[model samples]
Target: MTRLAYSALSSYSRVQIMRLVQDHPGRTITDLCDETGLHANTVREHVQRLIEGGYLVAETERRTTRGRPRVLYSAATGEAAASSPIARRKAEEAARRGDLMRRVLPWTADAELPSDALHQIDALVEDLGDAGFDPIIDEGALTVDLSPCPHASADGSHRDVLCAVHQGLMEGVLTQAGGPLRIAQITTSCDPSTCVVMLRR
Candidate 1:
């Protein structure tokens, strides 16, 4: 993942915008402004940042008889987002960084795992680390434990959107990593202290 992508999530307002787009794809800027009560300029800036970060996709609405179609936004997904040249290049760079960290760090136990699985975990860890999840991997159980999750502060009503977006990001990472491992599920909690992400081969 790129630093830009991680930084995009650092703002709570941006996170809310992301969740809104994820829940309701093809939302126009006006719709986001209406829902978020943010100024139109602020929403436009946030959306532009999200688009640059590869977290959101923008498309023009199609209309038969209209002066102009509105611009719509939606959350980027694993397959579609990773297909972009820039996104693929970033993923490849992240994979290289993950490999470097694995080699230099104290993750000696990772040696026992298959090469592909290790690569997947390396990518996952790097991405999660960038997002400040403080991920702990359970190799035997094929799960990643996230403690003091950055996204845990979201209100209960938006919890589902938070988790789903996170899960989608993980899937995107794995897909970009070109590994055999995948995110099977993410179990979120009412408490912000912990979340579990299950992996499957």
Candidate 2:
């Protein structure tokens, strides 16, 4: 295969490995082979690729028995593959927004909301409101809901416009927060003339 095709395939494999690691951290090569239904060799190949790509790291841990230690694999720390200029720009923007949230929100204090998700949603709503969005805070698996100005629309596709805006908004906000924001769900739909954004942070 060409270099480009190999790179694409490697990238896909890396993403698959990352997802597996996210779901089951500290998994072994045998575990991956079982989960992915691939041959042990194939699993090893993919895992090695991920390690070489700087997307994964491995450590050896000794079991309680008298046998030798087994190698355990896990996802790497720090950001990965911000290769393109646009992606780098987005990362920078997200970092700036996270800094703003750190300064404005009571991140240190445990929020009084019913749950952690609600607390994050509330924080997001407050931050968006402070940033001048007409937001409606909702409590659910997905945290904050938004209803930006309907009159601000130039075209009739208010839902699409609002979805894009809020997607950008959430990306910026979470990027600034400096960690992976566990987004359980995100649903964007239209409500009459206005667009509604439902998110779980």
Candidate 3:
């Protein structure tokens, strides 16, 4: 039997979700919530982080419903998700890749921000936290370190898309807050544990 260690590796909910998915590939988020007795939103957040970390895969489930499709998840490299648009469709540009990740990414049309630096920083932190980035803002340094990045990849190859989405999200929020700080460069780690964003005045 294989011995497993989980502490310091993942959050409690995330560990539970991954184990469940491994045991039951293609389990829907709702199914997982019921099994773990956790809230649906909590499960979804852990699942999203796992997916972003490349530890799990998410595919859409089809039903005759009018709203967003249900997502089925499994350990990474598991069987292709049944009816998954990403699994079925050809690879394309980041903007054109219509998937749940796109919808979750914190981005919208650009706007404006205030000249006051401190207020802008506070508002940006709130926005990022609401978006699940676990953000820590350093106004003196003009940088933010996001842990358990909801979009970073274990491999560096996908950083382009992941980093771009983060950049856009921050841009939108900062502009809306009336600070209009520009993104100087995004330093994504190959570790996939966190990513840092440096802002330009």
Candidate 4:
């Protein structure tokens, strides 16, 4: 049995079509067009791509009362299943992290504060630092540059910890000084040592 090459799959539409076929195997082009709200031509195009990419298999099924045989489409079940394990694992991990965030955010968002927002920023950096992250606060932005590159060093589990900590810090600050707080942007680079965060009020 040949395995599906996930890297060969690109484009949101193609991915969506594959997922639909996987869920409802042995469906027709008309069925997919109705389900996805895409035109028949568009569905055909994606299906052809999937078939060529080896992610799907096509067959003909004959009905007893039908005038002619109908062509049916279905995911290459064994190949699709094999290729999907990593993606499924990642999704499960993400869900778990989301649950953890839900629990942590409320506490962070409700904390009382004394004075000096800059001091609060310092405290957040200190906390992150103590937790093995090297945090730097400068010019209205706090950047936590992790030494070990969490993605490379730790399993996917650390994502929750990192997310919760950042959420806690943001909530703690915004709750105290309640007015427009902007989380400019958060990014991770291919190099684990380089993560940048931009923030503004």
Off by over 4 Å in 2: 1-14, 79-201
lDDT for each residue of candidate 3 in 61-87, tens digit (9 for 90 to 100): 787968888777866431233222321
TM-score of 3: 0.39
Tens-digit lDDT track of model 1 for 1-201: 236666777777788898887777889989999999999999999988877776777777788896898888877654663243444566677667767776788555465667667767876786687787788899888999997777667787776666767787778667766767888887766676688989988
TM-score versus the correct structure, for each prediction? 0.77, 0.38, 0.39, 0.37
Tens digits of per-residue lDDT for model 4, 1-201: 332333324444565666666667778989988888999998898887666544567778868895887778866533333232322332233334434553687443223322234333433343344334555545324443444543345445644344443443343333332234445666776655566556555
The per-model lDDT (C-alpha) reads 0.75, 0.49, 0.54, 0.51
Find the 10 residues in a row with the least total lDDT in model 2: 1-10
Off by over 4 Å in 1: 61-66, 81-86, 101-117, 151-160, 188-191
- TM-score top scorer: 1
lDDT of 2 by residue, 16-135 (tens): 555676556678988887777788887888877655533356778868889888888865433342122322333444345545665688463334433333334443554455444566
True lDDT of residue 45, candidate 2: 83
Off by over 4 Å in 3: 1-115, 153-159
| Clashes per candidate, residues 3 or more apart or on different chains | 0, 9, 5, 0
lDDT of 1 at 28: 91
